[model samples]
Target: MAKAFRTVLGERLRRLGKSIWWRHCTAAAFLVASLFVLPARALDNMSFVVRGGEDELTESFRAASLLVQSWNDGLTDPQTLFAAARADYGRLVGAAYAEGFYSVVVRIEIDGREAATIEPLDAPAAMREIRVTIEPGPRFTFATARMRPYAPGTQLPPAYGDTKPAFSTAIVDAAEAGVDGWRNVGHAKARVADQSITADHSADTIDSLILLEPGPRVRFGQMTISGAERMRPERIARIAGFPTGETFDPEELDTVANRLRRTGAFRSVALQEAETLGFGDTLDVDLVVAEEALRRFGVGAELSSTEGLNLSGYWLHRNLFGGAERLRVDGAIDRIGGQGDTLGYELGARIERPATPVTDASAFVEARVGREELADITLDKIELSFGLTRVLSDTLSAEAGISYIHTRAEDVTGSFEFDMVALPVSLTWERRDNPIDARKGFYLQADVTPFYGFNMTDSGAQFKADARAYRSFGAEDRLTLAGRVQLGTVVGTSLAATSPDFLFFSGGGGTVRGQPYQSLTVPLVRPSGVTVQTGGLSFAGMSGELRAGITEKIGAVAFYDAGFVSDDAIFGGNSDWHAGAGLGLRYDTGFGPIRLDVGLPVSGTTDDGVQIYVGIGQAF
Candidate 1:
């Protein structure tokens, strides 16, 4: 019985081996067939080469030629290659004209024969090479260039009538300047009436005559609003602040469009001028806006060695009341990985009304409640504030507010409760080209808040000023130098009597980063022979950074920060200085740059060897 079973098993194994061999042969045959058939159906392999031009000129010709860009992988057939080569001839000639080569010869060859001479039906079965050769003739110089009927104060470029190469771009630029000169002075209907250009191949010179018609100076008549669904038309007009009945200035139109967009209610805003002039030398402007969705929400997070992890979120309603009113609610929690009891929380809400009976002005009301436990203090606070903000210009603004705060605090000095009322006012001016990553400009802000405590005889005024400047050098602003100075002082009362929140404490991410959070403070000696940090009454901080962009999306920064916290209302003999130096890495994104900094204390009291901070945006 064993012998019979062995014979049956051997037969089954042999059958299985035969079946596997047949399947392998079938796959090999299929692969060989595919290799042979795919090539016959595939597109022809074509190569493009640009000759007769060198360096930037060669690159410019290639960039301008559509045929060069269209032949990405290869051409489908000889017919497609012929079509592409024919189109590239005109593009190459135009590119030469733009570079002051009025007389240029462009030749495209396919497989060693001119493409233009070949008939479509006689094209080769497969194309191997496409060659474009350019003969850029003698460059032309501007011999005579003139523009007529330009506004009296118009300024044209120096190359307009010089012996320099007569670039086509220069002629267009001169015409634009003539028209813009009129638009700047209230002639909104100005346009280029006629252009006469002649290129002399024999003399290697070009002559250009551009005539501009500055239509009669007009005034702004009215503004018609469109694309309003949830927002009111009247509110849109009010917020835009179009200067009606005033001389028509193109800048005013731009200002109106920018203002409407800044409200965050619109996805797009356009101001279109009437085609024909209106009666009484006036032009009616039309404002077309596409509104965005009403609600938006976002969440953000940050990490710090001393403060632990912070997480925050916000919700916004763009048109909460149909008048472009904005409402926002936000909350945050910090110190998530701390010593279990040092968690901090905050909740706040704000509502804003635009165009509050004044041009470029808004009113807002806000309320907040929070609890915080720092290194040497624990505090709980509730606050309410109402404010008016005015936009004086594109780069300047002012704000004034009244606030009430109730606080309960505990420190080494024991626990205390106080109610305070304050009147805060501030003015800010900023001219940075980019707020998130400033390359150049200056910023200045000054603030003053006077407060009165109801629980004790404490009345004082806090004054603070911040000034920053940014300057860039090198190609594409690859190197940026930024500096900032901050000054603050509390007057009219002692530090102990003032509200703890209003007092100044240095040594945190916002100040001297290498030290522990709020670790640098004035020492107060108690009767029990123990001294503790009790915050400071006056403070001054200075920071400077040298940021160098190593690549398009990568940057490195070296920074130094110094701060002083004083026991008196101003700097005195008892004041001490603390400093920190650090290097950082930045990765730029669409919204802003991701930042990581490692800081080390160079002066003052810092027990931690090194501190690290990770967040979005610049430290400033």
Candidate 2:
């Protein structure tokens, strides 16, 4: 296309040179063409040459080509595209003039195809190599993070501000919160203020300013509750922990709302901020609630490698007899290998009370009848339990319960009936759910069950005590070192002992780090001439395991365990110890660590065994 235009211009120039009228017409044509070819406004700042020498012109054309390519690829809107091209070309043309290029023209091609040509009418623009200089800029950090109206009161430790302390409880404890950040001042508010960091060759440090805003010291406002009555409005409100005139908090409001929701007592709850009091910026809370079905039902099915397939269903009355109470009836059918199949049923009721905004208490009672198969024994048992549980703190809790169980077992050898009754009490304390580094967090739990015959048979008074603790050494989730040890003993006229059969065995994912299930069991085969009374249970065992996280998702563990089972310390050498080590992979699912661990026995006599266990929540 350029060659054709050049040919036409050459002929026209020749004809114009021969006649004055033609010369005038040729000049006018040149001006019109110049409008199309003149460097776009963008050429002003760019460096280029229209005509100087081969080197200069080549560089200019190259630069223009690159500029055009960028424009075509980046600019989507036509107006913007044209504007950008004009500005760029205009800069380049101006730069070339400064650099002494008398004549220059820029041609644009896209995808190896020509698109447009631009140039100055009287001069050419050429761009050579460009020199770019970049210099370091000063970095900035938070100068101060502070709160308004000054944090209330003063008993708070200075550490709270110095360390940028966050609430030990859930952030929902804040005054007012929405999806992302603070919306309104609820009951209590906290924040980081005067936060600043300093870095230098000698040291680096973070300085923080923290604030707590516990909105206006106002008493509770009139609680306005709304929702279809599943029970009674007053009853639901009380269950929500909002007993009228209680000092109001946005956090408490949310907690109450959520608890009611999880009960399935409401379809939706809208807790609104309304009617404020001037004394201290307090508001009368108006909760707009929507009730769901008072009575509901659901069915579920599950398949497992060990338990096979099972179906279960439940019918629920969320607001049984009004108040914050619930009742349900459920049933299930499960099959066992070679033990035939059995059906089971149960009815249970639970009552929940929001004793406080941050605390909850509940009581539950359940009775169940089911058949279980263990080896040659086919047993049918009826069990009943009553329990009361309360949230001691966010990461700690305790519960106590009483249970009665009756079992009748039948085998080809014979049929026997047995009953076991016991009192169970347990306490669990966890700093972090599961730590990748075992040495950083602390998890301690202890449970004891002392029992007396609800019947006779092989029954005897027994006492079992178990405790485990772990600490994380690195980040909370990454465990660096951890250990667990447990022991159980029975004492009485004819009490139950920790037999090779009855001992609390510890070897698997949650126990001695490297042994398989029941590997810790003493072999039944005994040496000749050694008449051992295998019938009698014996001393309990102690297991200790150390685990270290290698990464956020991987860890190595080493462990040791020792135990003995004898009628009454028959042999001083009866106790034996086993040790092993292995590695594990952990996936953080927020809920807890999903662990996959593989281990090998280091001391015990056992086959090459691999244990694979998968379940929800944390192993500890």
Candidate 3:
């Protein structure tokens, strides 16, 4: 059994994420210590013999033989060897029972003496050979299988009944399924009242029965808060949103936890049910919260050969007003030294109040001011917005906001000014396993902003969507395939009248990697018959990557990206497309991955020697 344990432990240790390493440490600690002791070998080799069973079953017996592991690990202590052999009997029998073999015979021999007959205190200091023999009896089938008082939607395993081997695990699963079903339907204390199990050796059959006790249905009561500092108890209770006096649903506990977690005020949250029901059969739960620090700050940077270096930083106040409000201020500077691109800078601030208006919603006000100096234009802008964002489910959210914007611009043609009011609506659905380095699942986001211009600015709507999917395969999920598609269009507006910030561009690290920043642009004929470069009205882009793991923390990637830009709402008017292919390397730091990519122009007229990009997280 130790051998099987060590094998499974080795695999699990490699597969463990940092959050779960504490679970299996106790059982393996001593054995891991033994690995460094340099103990001499008592036995040269151990033999595992099975008199009757399939090849797979025989292999299972070998794995369950602790004597085999003792020899393999080169442990010479006779008492240790004897203890391991003695313990393996129960382990082997349990393994047999798991395979529907109720009657199994197991024996271990140490130097021609039956280990079961040898006394523990009489262990020899030295031994030459150790062998184990196992005979698994005929598998049993279920002659009668039944569990009573199932809830409305209970689903039992199909193999628990007739015409199949009666696995012991199936019986346990059925019992758990029955209890969970009752809990799903408001029975908060359902349990198994009685169980009867019998085996008929002569007929090679088994009979099983389980009776469930579905305790009285219940309603939810108030939540008592604990472990909170610098946060009001009333707000914590409000965010919990427990349906006091309403029929209980088991999923509500998870919902309440998520609500508090999304506020970012708590580092950890836990709910404990009362030992006894409250008055009127109400279920009261205690909410324990460990508050996060009041303040935090972080910085990030990204570099591109053509677009230069981009650096950003932010300061956060988790509990700005003792009501789970978050205040964040951030700034960014980019285009330090690029291929014809000028410096740009942006500063923004946002304040978010959680559980405002409703438990699942938050309200926020944001303000921003920025300046950009591009190859063909120089612009400055200021904006203010207020909005409500609601969490519809674990993986979906929606937001709507109204904003006022003003901009001043100087292009090659002349100078321009615009003032606009806009309403922006967005939806996001995300199911990725890890946001920073996704291994599976998909993400989708769509936004529509309709703007009303004052005098000469264009009245139009901006439509944009980004969709990404990741699929991983092979042992330990060592290979992943990731893909992304981006689409955008501006409708009810003329190309020359649209704000430069709202227009679409396809180049730099964000679109076609190997192409120069904003190099792929549409031509706009000025009133004087001269033409200048300008952003397109419509855009489409696609990126795909195949990643292979080189080690536990290192990986390699091959990717291709292509983009299209058009002057018309659709692809009817003048259009240009470009493509770039790249190979990259990644080093995972648990929090996220360090990314490095080298790109070369694959299908574009403007080809640079090569482009290098460095950043954090995946490209998408």
Which candidate leads in TM-score?
Answer: 3
Per-candidate Cα lDDT values, in order, are: 0.79, 0.45, 0.82
TM-score of candidate 1 to 2 decimals: 0.86
| Per-structure clash totals for the candidates | 0, 60, 1
In model 3, the Cα lDDT at residue 406 comes to: 93
**Residue 562 displacement (Å), model 3:** 1.0
lDDT of 2 by residue, 254-328 (tens): 676765675567788877656457445445667787777788887754332233445678888777766646677
Question: Which portions of model 1 miss their true places by more than 4 Å?
Answer: 1-54, 71-80, 118-125, 339-341, 453-457, 472-479, 525-531, 548-554
How would you order the candidates by lDDT, starting with the best?
3, 1, 2
**Which ten-residue region of model 3 has the weakest summed lDDT?**
16-25
**Sort order, TM-score high to low:** 3, 1, 2
Model 2 lDDT on a 0 to 1 scale: 0.45
- lDDT score at residue 500, model 2, on the 0-100 scale: 24
